[model samples]
Target: MSRGAQVGVATVYRRFPIKEALLTEAFAEERDRTLQLLLDLVRRAQEAGALRRDFVLEDVGLALMANAGIRAQSPEVRAEASRRFAA
Candidate 1:
């Protein structure tokens, strides 16, 4: 799923106070799920020679963070940004 599709999930995370004790714990499950999926895709990309062997989980984190930072004037633009990020 694209980041745009995850807006609700993101909103849920944002709802908790920044310093909430259980916030990290709550987000961990979703984070792990997303990480595993990214790892799977990375492995395939490597096998297809589209990605280098040096890729790591941290790169996935960085990519997600970068995508999250994207802002647009409208829903259509935001959706486009998510598609571009996925690509």
Candidate 2:
């Protein structure tokens, strides 16, 4: 992990002692970026006239949650660190 990500994990660990808690907190950040990627996909779809403007952020979020590789190291730990990637 990069220094920034390491710091984020450290902060999370400080806030929550358990690794599972820390990973869950980190996963939320991952989810947000995944949601953004979905938003971009939606924008592209709209530009291509494939998706209607009626599509909302929630829809994008759901799409991302399903398609994005948001896998956890373990079911309990929920480590989405693999999703912490460079663009």
Counting clashing residue pairs in each candidate, in order, gives 0, 0
> Which regions of candidate 2 are displaced past 4 Å?
1-14, 17-20, 60-87
Superpose all Cα atoms of candidate 2 onto the true structure and report the RMSD in Å to 1 decimal. Answer: 12.6
Candidate 2 backbone overlaps, count = 0
- Stretches of model 1 off by over 4 angstroms after superposition: 1-19, 62-87
> Which tens-of-lDDT digit does each residue in 1-87 have in candidate 2?
338656576566578899787678779998889878978887998999987878887774465566456566685444445334210
Taking all chains together, each candidate's TM-score versus the true structure is 0.46, 0.45
Judged by TM-score, which candidate is best? 1
In Å, residue 55's CA in model 1 sits off its true spot by 1.6
User: Candidate 1: TM-score?
Assistant: 0.46
